[model samples]
Target: MSKRKQNLVGYLFALPWFIGFSVFLAYPLVASIYFSFCDYSVLKKPVFIGLDNYRELFADEVFWITVKNTAIYAAISLPAGMVMALGLAMLLNAKVPGTTFFRTVFFLPSLVPMVSLAVLWLWILNGEHGVLNEVLRMVGIRGPNWLGDPAWSKPALVVLGVWGVGNAVLIYLAGLQDVPTSLVEAAELDGASPWQKTRHVTIPMISPVILFNLIMGIIGTLQVFTVPYVMFPGGSPARSTYFYAMYLFDNAFLYNKMGYASALAWVIFAIILVLTGIQFLLARKWVHYEAGR
Candidate 1:
């Protein structure tokens, strides 16, 4: 085969992915950008209304409420999940009996389908007949309405978020296993306590993985949906659990405000981009790589 034929063959192999990207990803993204500037309803043609959707979003009180709710959830859940996951990973990283079994048990929650998990948690956190409240009742303490009260609803969702930190645990476990033994041994020789070994050696070595998990956790928590949607339906009591993604979903589907939804989606995209960028920038100071060492 000649050079041109080989080139053609390579292009043929890449064509499917290129076509899919154009049709599925690129086109929709471009369309959404256009739609964001328009007044689009699913049933009717989109009318150009530059910045109207954005202006409405800025003026919309519920928009700010959802933003606040989403930010708080992400802020709390991200760090909490990271801490839980890292602790679990460290525990399992120890040479204990049945470590594999314990790892599997802890990681199993993440494998449960989101819808099923949501349903299970609904029953578990039920105000009256739930297992959690029952335990509290047995201990002579009454549990608050987890899914009902505005104050506790977001916290209940945070618990659910942390339960799925099994995924992060696995990631951290991998990072822990990859940490250089020589460094740990050196720390041990210097009379470093276990906590000191972990703080001075293990954690610094796994800083990259920590950064990775932090970024992913931030993104996931910010885009949290199904669980809250299933548990609370539209919005929780006083709209306390009305997250940004949920509100965006309502705008697009329930209210037939595709333009507003598009704007909201772009805003979310921008927020995620900015946050991830900031994380990367800050990682330079604390996230030590082997190359840096």
Candidate 2:
């Protein structure tokens, strides 16, 4: 084909994707920005309202509650999940019998659908007659009401978050496998114990992977919705389990506050952006990369 004809053909091939992007992703994002500054509902024409939505959102008690809940959940779950995943990854990386089988068993939970996982955990964490409580009773310890008590509710969700760290474990396992055997051997030659070697060598080598998982965990934990929504309907037990995303969803759908929801979404986007920037800045201190990386 001639040069111009070839260029036209290429454009034709790219047109579908360009159109889809413009219509779906780009348009919705732009529309949301406009809607955020208006008094909008699905059934009514949006009326420009300046900063009213943002002002109202800031004053909403439930908004503050959801923010606190989300922050606390992320603070607890992020580190806990990362540590658990890294530990499991290290264990799986070791040469042991049935390692593949154990890896598969551990990873299967992550493959389960989120809704199904939530329902399954719902049964396990039931205040009475749950399998966890049953096991605790067998050990002569009474298990507290996991989903019922506000004090324990967030912790229960944290347990659920930790249970689904199989994906992170796989990522960590990859990083572990990539560590330089020579470095580990040098540490051993220096009479470093396993714990010392892991602390000094393995972790530092895998710092990049740890940073990736940390950023992902922050995003996921901040937007936690489906699991908690399914397990703790309406953030019951006094809304202690209510989170930012859940509150946004309720505002948009249940309360028909699209403008407010849009504003809340923009705030969420800003928070994620700022936090991610902070992580990138702090990563310079510890996230090491090989030369030419």
Candidate 3:
């Protein structure tokens, strides 16, 4: 084909994807920005309202509650999950029998559908006749109502978050395997204890991986929805389990406050962006790169 004709053919092939992107992703994003500044409901046209939505969001008590809940949940779950995942990965990386089987067992939970997992945990964490409580009772201890009490509800969800760190464990396992054997041998020759070798050599070598998981855990924990939503409907037990994303969803759909929801969505985007940027900034001091080193 001639050059111009070939170019035209290529454009034709790309046209479908370009159109889809403009109609779906690009347009919605732009529309959401505009809508955030207006009073909009899906059933009616958006009316420009200046900064009213944002002002209202700041004053909204429930919004603040959700923010506080989300922050606390992330603060507790993120580090705990990372530590547990790393520990499991290290254990799996050791020269132990049935390693493959154990790896599969750990990873299998992550493959379960989110709804199913939530429902399963719902049963497991029930206040009465639950497997966990049953075990506690076996040990002559009375278990607290995990989902029925506001104080324990958030912690219950944290447990679920930790349980599903299988994906993070796999990532850590890969990073662990990539550590230099020579460096470990040198540490051994220097008479470093197991903890010293791990702290001085293995962790530093996997610092980049740690940074990746930390950023991902921050994002995931901040946007937590499914399990809590399913297990604690309407953030019951006094809204202690209510999270930012769940509130956003309720505003958008249940309350039909599209404009307010859009504003909230933008705020969430900004929060994630700022936090991720902070992580990247701090990573410079700790995350090690072989090439940079």
Candidate 4:
């Protein structure tokens, strides 16, 4: 066959994927961007409105509420999850007895189906009869109504979200395994304390993995939906759990404000882009990539 024929054959093979991308991903993205600038409802033809949707979105009280809630969730959950995962990974990295069993125990929660996990957490955090509260009662400590009260609701969600950090733990563990033992041995021979060695050697070596996990955690927290939605469908006790994605979902479907939702989604996309870019910029100072690896 001629080179041109071979090239045509390759293009034929790639056509399906190209078509799928154009139809599903690229087209929808472009459409949403356009829709965000118009006045669109599913039942009505979209009319170009020139940033009216964006202006209205900024003025909407619920938009600001959802932003505050999402920001709070991201601020609290991301660091807590990352720190917990790193600590767990460090513990599991130690050559302790029954480490495999403990690792399994820690990771099992992440494998639970989302619905099942939500239900389980609902029960566990129930104020009146929860196992957690019951234990607190035994210790003569009063347990707050976690999901019921607006003040405590987001924290409850954060706790539930942190339970699934097992994946992060595994990633950190992989990074830990890749750290050079030669550096560790040198630190030990230099009579470096355990904390000193971990701070100077292990952490710096695993900085790239830490950066990866941090960025992912930030994005995940920003787009948190299922857990909060399932736990508090009505936004619960005055919209404290009404996160950005949930608000966007309600605007798109429930409220029949497709344009507004599209605008909200674009805003979210912008926020994620900005935050992720900031992380990458800051990572230049900390994330250590080894030579030739």
Candidate 5:
């Protein structure tokens, strides 16, 4: 095929995604950037109001609270969940008798739709008549109201995060498959124990994959909305599970503070960007890519 024809064909194939993105996603993003600077109340036309929305961000007490809650949730969930996932992956990699069964069991939760899973968990973690609390009772320990209590609500969501650890485990499993067998034997010959082999060779080789999952996990956690939004009531039971995205949604749709919500959106995007950048920077010290010296 001629060069021009090939280029034209490539563009034709790419056109659908480009058009959908521009219409559905890109337009909203650009609109939000403009919306962030306006005095929009959702009932009236937006009026340009420079940095007013941003200034309010600092003074906004609830915004700061949401930020803190979100940060705490992410800090608690990300490392813990990844560690759990890595541990599970390592165990699964050992080629157990029921490896496939365990893999299926682990991955079943991620397969379930988010709404369905949330509703199921709601009942399971209910203050009374719940299986989890009943199990606690079996152990002679009184269980707290998980969703109804503010202190336990966020932690409950972290527990829910376990359901999706299967996906991370799958990624780690793929990385494990790529690990060199010769390297393991060589390390064993050098008197390295199984722990040492994994610590030095297996982990370093899979560090890039680990880093990929970490980045995705961080971004996913930051934008977490549905699980908490559904599991606990929206901004409910003293607003304990009111995630940052949930708060942003409430401002825009429920409260009619469109401009402020847009401002919140921009801040979220910026925060994610900064956090991702920091991860890449810090990964230089820890994430061992094949090309890195």
Candidate 6:
């Protein structure tokens, strides 16, 4: 076949996805960008307000609170969850019996629906009648009002976030398996201890994967909503766990401020874009790729 015919065939094959992307993803994003500058109540028409939505966001206490809470949640969960995932992956990578069983046990939590897990945690972390509190009481430690207290709500969500580390662990495990064994053996033969070998060889080899995880973890945590949204039953006791996405949801749905919500969504998009850009800028110094070198 001629190259022109091949090109036409490829275009035909990709037609559905291209059409869907244009209609669903691209159109909504463009529409939201337009809406962000307007005031729309869904029932009525949009009136252009020029940056008023953004101007109002700066002074809105709830917006700032949601930003702070979201930042804290992302900061706490990203590194913490990634580290836990790496540790679990390392454990699973070791030669041992029942390795598959352990992997299965650790990963089972990720299989459960987020809504279901949040409901389960609500019952288990209740201030008085919680299973977690009961366990703590058995050990004579007073369990704080987890969902009721603003101090504990975000932290409790972070704890719940750890349960999702299984997905990260699975990714890290694949990376670990792909690491070059020769480098490890060479380090070992040079009288380097296991710790030294891991620090020098294992880590560097998997640095790309680490970078991948770091970026994805940051993005995922920044957009976190499910655990906090459902666990607290309306932004927690004092809006402590009210994430930016949750606030966006409230504005769009509960309050019917679609235009403002679009503005908030765009702001989130900008934040994520900046963060991902920063990660790319910094990756040059630390994220090693052997093939690239």
User: In candidate 5, which residue pairs clash?
Assistant: none
Better of 4 and 6 by TM-score: 6
260: Cα error in model 3, Å = 0.3
lDDT of 1: 0.94
lDDT of each: 0.94, 0.95, 0.95, 0.93, 0.90, 0.91
**What's the CA RMSD for each of the models?**
1.2, 1.7, 1.9, 1.6, 1.4, 1.0
Residue 190, candidate 2: Cα error in Å is 3.3
Residue 169 error, candidate 6, Å? 0.1
lDDT per residue as tens, model 4, 68-164: 9999889998989988999999999999899999888989998998888999999999999998899999999999999899999999998998899
State the weakest 10-residue window (summed lDDT) of model 4.
284-293
Indicate whether candidate 5 or candidate 6 has the larger lDDT: 6
Q: What is the TM-score of each candidate against the true structure?
A: 0.97, 0.95, 0.95, 0.96, 0.96, 0.98
> Which lDDT tens digits does candidate 1 get at residues 1-293?
99999999999999999999999999999999999999998789999999999999999999999999999999899989999999999999999799999999998998999999999999999998999999999999999999899999999999999999988999999999999999999889999998899888999999999999999988899999999999998787889999999999999999999999999999999999999999999999999999974
Which residue pairs does candidate 2 place in steric collision?
none
Clashes found in each candidate (C-alpha, N, C closer than 3 A): 0, 0, 0, 0, 0, 0
Candidate 3 C-alpha lDDT tens digits along 1-293: 99999999999999999999999999999999999999998999999999999999999999999999999999999999999999999999999899999999999999998899999988888899788999999999999999999999999999999989999999999999999999999999999999999999999999999999999999899999988888888998899999999999999999999999999999998999999999999998988898995
C-alpha lDDT (0 to 100) for residue 244 of candidate 2: 97
Name model 3 segments beyond 4 Å from true. 1-17
Worst 10 residues of 2 by lDDT: 284-293
lDDT of 6 at 21: 100
Alpha-carbon error at 67 in model 3, in Å? 0.3
